[model samples]
Structure formats: structure tokens, C-alpha cells
Target: MDLAMLLAVAGLAQTPAPAKLPLPVELPAVANATADPTCGNRPALAERATCVVSTQAGVEGVLQAYEAVFTPQGWLVADASGNVVIYMKRKPEGGCDAFQVLAFADGEMAAPAAPAYLAFATIPRDICQAADPNAAAPAQ
Candidate 1:
């Protein structure tokens, strides 16, 4: 390659990558989210990523608060039960990451001691499959 071409190639290689945007974390828990020391690599419950949070808020309060927080970010309430709401958001930029957040309020059991909440989010649905594609043999 010519000298100019070689220099251009090197410059391209050294070009700083786009600034890595901070990966969004669970919201704060002062009526917000407490930082999970695990840094959000939480376990899966019912085939979705999960996290437990402690809050003094009741079901209605939590529903209202989280709706305000997530709705502006384009997440929609996919499903809701009496004390639980499941919010889901697909990557709008056309990526495979689909997050479903399950927020449950259990004040009856956890009350008088500061109610606790559970939230499951950022789950990739493709991993929860019934058939094991990698298995080469049937169970004996």
C-alpha cells in the first residue's frame, strides 16, 4: 500500500471508539432502587432476569412510581396482576436485548418492617428454551 494509505489505515485503527455509554442500572431505591452489590447480574426467576429491592412503598405507590420512571423510556406495561406489574421494552435500535421488568409489591407480609419489592429486568428471552439444542442424546 502507498505511504499515505498506510498512515490512513493506522489512523483509522487508532481512532477512539465511540464513548461507551454507561450501561443503565436499576433505578435508585429511596422510593428508588438500591444498588445491587452484584452489579445487576441477577438470577432468573420464571425465565426472566430478577432482582429484589427493599422499599416501604405499597403496590399502588410502586406502580405509580415505576410507571413514571419507565414509561418515559419507552417501556410498556406488558402485563399486570393485583400486586405485580410486568414492564417490557425491546431494543428500539433493533437489537436482540429485550428487557422485562417484573415488579411485585408484598406489603401484607413485609409490612411494619419496611416493605420490600422484587424487580426483574433486562432479560434476554431467547435463553429460556424447552428443548436443549446442544444435547446430543435423549435422557436415559
Candidate 2:
């Protein structure tokens, strides 16, 4: 077998994996997502950011869409809190740190204005490990 084929067989291919989880589609007039807030603002150690998509989609619809997007990129669900599901994967950047994605849906929070909001968070690898109990091991 050729060198490329041999590497693939050995699971040693150097192909670059997706750096992060696939971002959910953002609907019109989307707003910036914020952190849990209770974690306090410690920007020096790790950074946190959120993305929101406004849509009329249902809970399952939103969750399924994210699963499809993240799965293809090698992201796996790590843990779920209430309605917010957390996914994690090993990231090559940031010194082989762990990356995390949090997907959630809320209709009431937006009130009679947005109708529904699909939100997700991009958390630093170190931050994810420290915060998630499911961080026992890297997601396959």
C-alpha cells in the first residue's frame, strides 16, 4: 500500500481535523450571546463567547440540526444540563486543549418579540474541562 493508504490504515493520518464545532445557522437580527454571568468575569484565563440564531424552529428541530452539524466535524455530546446540551472535542490549537460547544433553545426568554432563540456557546478547552463533569475524557 502507498504511504497515504498505510497512514490511514494505522489511524495516523495527519489530515487536519475541524478546529471547532460547526456553528448553528443564525436567523435574522441575531443578537450576541453572553456567558452564564455567575462564573464571574475572569477574562485573563479563558475567553467565552456566544452565538444566537432566532427562528421558529422547535426544540428537537434545533437540537437535531446542531447534532448533524457537529457530528460531521467530529464533535460529540459530552453532557447536558437542563435543556442545554454540551458537546466536546479535542482541539489541536491552544496546546492540544479541549474545546466545548453548548447548544440551547428558549422561547420564553425572547418574549413576544423573537418568538424563539437558538443559542450556542464557544468555550475554551481549559474552561470546558474545569466546568464539565463529562470532561472525564476527550470526546471521540
Candidate 3:
């Protein structure tokens, strides 16, 4: 084969690599999310400040507020839109009854002023279940 023809064939044989989709990024920490003084000196239940971790998907706020509540040990469940369905680790068999779900928002984290708690009675019992049986259940 001619040198020019060989070179052309070789070039054609080498395809460019496929472009990569960007990996999902983690939500950034909330700016200036400090403890609320009003919550201080109140009863335990009322004193806790919910920390909302906002992301592209949605807001995942954690109630039962302690500083750095989501650090080290916590559970984060994201929806298709990247919204986090936040759940703290269940406490023994009682499960996650003690926690609360805040509002959903579009951003990296919910604003400090976001609503902190949902009505306890309104929360579904299954949300506190230890395992996600629906995901594991056999398809009908």
C-alpha cells in the first residue's frame, strides 16, 4: 500500500474516545449555618436545630440538631433528581422516629431559616423501617 493510503487507513481505524458524562457532585456545606440561640436553653426536643444539606437533587435536612450532625454517622438517600431523602441511622428497634424531614429546595443546602420539623404523627411508619423492603421485595 502507498504511505499516504496506509496513513489514512490507520487514522480512520483509530476512533476518538467517547465523551464522559460528569460524575454526580456532592452538596456543598451551608454557609453561616450557626446554632440558633433561641433553640438554646429550651427543652431537649425544642432545642435541637435541624441541619439541612441542600444539593442539586433537593434538600435533605437533619433534625435532632447537634453540630456537624451529618458528619461521621448518618444516612443519605438521593432521588433521581439528586434530591436527598435524608435519614439518620435507626436507633435500635425504634428506628428513625426521633428524626424529622424538612422542606425540599433547589440548591446545595437549605437555608438556615428553613422549617425544621415535620409533624411526627404525619410521618409514615414504613419510613422508619430498618430495611427498604420495597427495593428488596420480589417484583410482582
TM-score of each: 0.43, 0.41, 0.26
Query: lDDT by residue for model 1 over 1-140, one digit each (tens)?
Result: 11121111112223343322222444545464553433123222322333545454443454466568777877676656543444555554533333444444332343423534444455434222313366355479
> Which ranges in model 1 have alpha carbons more than 4 Å from their true place?
1-33, 36-52, 55-59, 82-84, 90-97, 103-114, 126-140
Q: What TM-score, to 2 decimals, does candidate 1 have? A: 0.43
Question: Candidate 2: which stretches are off by over 4 Å?
Answer: 1-49, 54-57, 92-114, 127-140
Model 2 / residue 21 / CA error / Å = 13
Give the range of the ten consecutive residues with the poorest summed lDDT in model 1: 1-10
CA error at residue 135 for candidate 1, angstroms:
26
Write the residue-wise lDDT of candidate 2 on 55-139 in tens digits: 3333345456556766777667776544445666665652223333333233223232232333344543455457656657667
lDDT of 3 by residue, 1-140 (tens): 11121111122113442322221222234443333333222233222332333222221223223215444455443211222134444556555532333333222343444323221111234455535654455569
| Cα-based lDDT for every prediction | 0.42, 0.39, 0.30
Q: Write out the backbone clash pairs for model 3.
A: 54-108, 54-109, 57-82, 57-83, 58-83
Compared with the true structure, the alpha-carbon lDDT of candidate 3 equals 0.30
Order by TM-score, highest first:
1, 2, 3
Query: With candidate 2 superimposed using the best TM-score fit, by how many Å does residue 118's alpha carbon deviate from the native?
Result: 2.0
Error of 2 at 88 (Å): 0.6
